[model samples]
Target: MENTMTKSILKNKCLIIDGTRAFMMVWLGQMISFIGSGLTSFALGVWVFQKTGDITQYALISMFFILPGVLLGPLAGTLVDRWDRRTTMFISDLGTGLSTLSIAVVYLLGGLQVWYIYVAVFLSGAFGSLRMPSMQAAMTMMIPKKSLGRTSGLMEIVQIGQFLIAPIVAGGLMESIGLAGIVMIDFSTFLIAISILLFIHIPRATVTAEGCAGQGTVLQEAVYGWKYIKARPGLAALMVLFAFTNFTTEMTVVLFTPLILSFASTAKLGLAMSLCSSGFLVGGLLMSIWGGPKRRVPLMMILMILLGVFSTMIGLRASVGLIVVSGFLATLTVPIISSSNQVIWQKKVAVDVQGRVFAIRRTITLATPLVTYAIAGPLSDLVFEPLMTVNGALAGSFGQVLGMGPGRGIGLLFVCMGLLTTLVTAIGCLSPRLRKVEEELPDAVITQSAQVKIEKKLPSLLPARSPRNKIVYAKCHDLKPPLPELLSRD
Candidate 1:
């Protein structure tokens, strides 16, 4: 009995040691790069708000992140599936570096306009649209399922670490080197990421048995993602649900910044943003240690409830401390949501096809942020601002608390938005489908588990199979294709 216990402890330690290398290979470079990127992003956001002092201009920064992703997702997803994933990631890092260098040059040249910054941000989004999905897809291929929860939790910690530090760093850096220094930091980190990535080799992915997923025309491959998602009821539902959540969150944010700014200043904006990062940091830390509940859906629902409460709190009254605390609470649930979502994909999707499937998945998931960017500016600037004022529609009652003038009116609208988000969650939870996601969307078991679940049942498949089995075989990561498809494939 003692020997058995000792062996178990040693095995657990070995797993940790193995994971430490994986974390360095996968997570460390990303975390360092993200911190630098966060610094640049925060610096840009504050600079815009400080210079224009307009909420619309502030929201445009988000557009820079969203528009390109939505517009280019289809093609990007196809190409990502078609290319070598590690190379794709390296290229993405390099692309961002190039963009950063250009922005730095523009700053030095003193030709840095709102339009230039906007364009750079858009380009970064475009490149990022390619990079993020590839990285996500790679994780499933490389990491073991049992450890996925921990790995994703650690990655979130890294992300939150960046956010927690960025605002504080950006704020101080602004006083010292301005935008150029932030851009410079971003540029350097990308190089560091590229250097690390150069050493890791990811085997090229290709479909087998049924047909080559990569040999098709762009449109053919792109449509396949649509077909793939439609075939899986659970995956489609996750995408659509996340799209709504993303849209609402984006819209609320458009309203959120202005609401806070009215009650405070740009520096206060930095402080609030940093504090918001604290919620994510703390949440991530807890997740890395405790992990999540075995059932993911319930945990996600509870997190959504907290998000609604916090959103409403920020809008109801604009105390700086209250706003910062509320923002912190709003992000606190992120690690749970994100890590679980990653586990879902890693388990359900095949590593080979994950590149395309996840790409399309990410593309659609990104739509809300784009929609928010598109509409938030107009709605807050024009409609809500007008309706909630002293002499406007709700002036008699709401105007007393929200006030007659500019910022508070917008704040009131944001409060209403928070309620709407909460209502949506209530409705979503009541859905039989989302509630039963586990039963319906069972994890997409890998064809051959490298360990205990290794396939003892390697069923034989002829070159041309029964059509349905043929397609299934083609999609399997375990099925190595006939030579020509594997060799002439890329």
Candidate 2:
């Protein structure tokens, strides 16, 4: 009996470790594909700006990238839950690749038009939306509960690598091999990602009462994610805060390229962007090593406030050096903020319902950015740009302080965005519900011991549903009432 028990424990440990291995495998393929897509994206941004010489048209690309994701997120999330996550990711990658290939073909044959690029971007975004929730849900299945923060940080590294490397390389490649070659490379990356998915297996989430409650017709299931969030005031408030921050971030993103290109050459723009984006890599590495602080809310809020301060610095001067330094500082806070927030949701929400819940969370937060992208260009070109010119209205006051010129108006806008972001973050920090959310919410993640017990057929030791119909998993860290006392109550 002793030997049998030991064997059971060993088997469970192997299964848990295998899940981590699977996660790394999937992550590798995605990382490669991310770099490839970044190349195409950077090349296209340069191409569009050069072609039209219009910030409004350049901003349209970002708007299209976000619009479909915000619009279709709920439906995509429901579908992710209903379907196999691995398969959904597979299809999503394939569809996005096809869209990219279409752009390459159009460019080669009939000569690519601006409208063609927009159509391709729209189709790509529509397909890419399905990948986000599915990937997050898959991560929950593959990663241990305690390691979610580190893993999220690791994921950020992929994003950082894409941004840090792609711009510098794409700028050079565009002059040599050209955009067509870049697009084909991106399509090949999709194939590599799908091939990896074909080999690896992602575990299905265990059905809980929360997951069951969310099960219904398509429309009903889609709406249930919103209801789930509404019931948790902390999560709802967190999402609202994210929406506001995302708005400010998008406003900056739409303007950054134009801001740099205004007073500098394309080569300098690439160099400045590459230098700034390196901060993302550094932050990701730090988070991966340290796994963030224990009190995540305070850390997140503090970083957000710092992010605002950095944004203000970006537009204080027209120098590339200033923009590089400020941009780097601003991006440094992003991965830390994102990883902490992601870990909170991972810990609090049940795995089975994560797809729908994460989907809705994404939709709400991203909705703000859609509006930001749509209006940022016109606002910069028409309103802000005109106000800070040499003979413009605000030239005597605000322009004197910020310096009057082509990009100075946009610089003034950045100062306003930075101030607003800081103010909003400060207000969010004061919310007791948001601040003390960790104390209020019980951990929904299943423990390794719980998994072991379930596999060993110790039904009596398994978790039970709480009065609130929540699964009361035995978290090893909840020591106040003692593990046995908590389990007994459940």
The number of the candidate with the highest lDDT is 2
What's the CA error at residue 140 for candidate 2, in Å? Answer: 1.4
lDDT of 2 at 124: 96
RMSD of every prediction: 8.8, 6.9
Sequence-dependent TM-score of model 1? 0.81
TM-score of 2: 0.86
Model 2, 85-113: lDDT tens digits are: 87789889999999999999999896899
Every candidate's lDDT: 0.69, 0.82
Q: Could you tell me which 10 consecutive residues in candidate 2 have the lowest summed lDDT?
A: 466-475
Spell out the clash pairs found in candidate 2. Answer: none
* Per-residue lDDT value at 348 in model 1: 64
Q: Candidate 2 — which residues are off by over 4 angstroms?
A: 1-17, 46-55, 106-113, 452-490
Error of 2 at 225 (Å): 0.9
Clash count of each predicted structure:
1, 0
List candidate 1 segments past 4 Å from native. Answer: 1-20, 44-61, 109-115, 201-215, 399-406, 445-490
